[model samples]
Target: MISTQKSFEKKEQGSLYLVPTPIGNLDDMTFRAIQILKEVDYIASEDTRNTQKLLNHFDISTSQLSYHEHNTNERTPQLIEKMLNGQSVAQVSDAGMPSISDPGVELVKAAIESGITVVPLPGPNAALTALIASGLTPQPFYFYGFLPRKKKDLVASLVDLNKREETLVFYESPHRIKQVVEQMVIVFGAERQIVLAREVTKRFEEFVRGTAPDVLEWLENEQIRGEFVLIVEGNSDIEEEAPQSWESLSLKDHVEELMENQDLPSKKAIKEVAQLRGLQKREVYAAYHEINE
Candidate 1:
């Protein structure tokens, strides 16, 4: 059901405003955003102390409540209740837009379930800022926020992500950029073109563009600092290889062939064959182990 309400004109309960703050430069803050910050009754901030600086600079004296990941479970209901009682609220992150790899999404969902209005304001974001100048395809892009920290899970995730056909965008910190690119080279191949946009909208802003191997070479000697937005070209040359013939092989032999060819463990290879043949995992397991017995 698509329900539309005339924002700022309808007379009812309070609204939830999602305001965007400047990513780095203070000058990027819009005038209307400043007015909304001042006009709202209370602000739900990711970091109250960090938001105070932005508030103090514009001389906006709105009260704030800490609403980060750690406190969202307890704070979301309180914020929703306050809005239900007709107290206007504005949600903000430490920087950039609220709920983009941030903590405002739960609160927004809570508010909507309770029938409170949500009003989102458009403004600065790190990913799009870097992408427009990245010289990569902007449309049909995938904005995959921070990659997983663990190497195994990260590699597995990248293995699945490597098949995507659209340009991929990601946010990465300085410390992991080099290692992350190295891993990308393994999954996506060394010749895949990638771009790193660093410290956007700030004084030392930079855009580094090259193949994955080329960037890995640059990171060897230079000191890495600042946050990063990575743009990678899609796999346009994905080869259409023919599937291996399983017609002549029995169930046990097919599982063995997959284990050797795909470098999969017995259990994993059995599961793969089951999925490929629309058979149950237990059935494949039984067939494979029967030969071993």
Candidate 2:
């Protein structure tokens, strides 16, 4: 299971470089990212047209192929084959790092399985960029890239995250920004401090800092624009609780204990037990219902 990759060493297979693009400002693009894009035999881009603009701006003509979410399954094997055939590739998203709230994870995994070197060139990222300037504790921050769209799922996710002491970061579209903050006020309480960084690293870059309710009030009066990074202060007054260990319990007992302790339904408890034990949900479901049915 252990594998070592010498990124710069000469090898038979070509390297698959993970190149990061600027979130907004073009000047933020690193020199090595540009060089990799130009030198690579192919550039697998999330949006070929959007990446073409960046390439054109830099005056680098690299042949590109579409590699977005829609076409990930179809293109992953093809890209892997190219790298295995000794053709280097550079994977990039529309902005920021590839596979960060973007497509390219499957291709990267396939490339690694086929012994292709993946060299990641770091550059612009909206999460860390916003976190540093949000006037919140920057270290030990949790980056939860976009929240679930469904109201039920969103609240459930926030309910779990509200217990952490580290700062939380999230990405939200302009359309959902208002609704997300409204829910945050409910789950995280109106008094908790939060920062909204909109249009980060762009011409109209702005940060709105205050309690959750204050930011919600500001949003109600203003026209929200551009992408947003929501930075929330962690739960400082969270009560310390003993960790629940399932070592002594059987798999079925573990499921029952979760249902009884957490007040979760049988299905949800079984799923939780499966996740906690790293077993398949189907496996846990069967074990929890040995004689039934």
Q: RMSD, each candidate, Å? A: 5.4, 7.5
Candidate 2 lDDT score at position 94? 97
Q: Which stretches of candidate 2 lie over 4 Å from their true place?
A: 241-293
TM-score of each: 0.85, 0.83
Candidate 1 is scored at a TM of 0.85
Per-residue CA lDDT of model 1 for 35-103, tens digit only, reads 999998999999999999999999999999999999889999898888888899999999899999888
- lDDT by residue (tens digit), candidate 2, 152-204: 99999999999999999999999999999999999999789999999999999
Q: Give the TM-score of candidate 2.
A: 0.83
Q: Model 2: how large is the Cα RMSD against the reference? A: 7.5
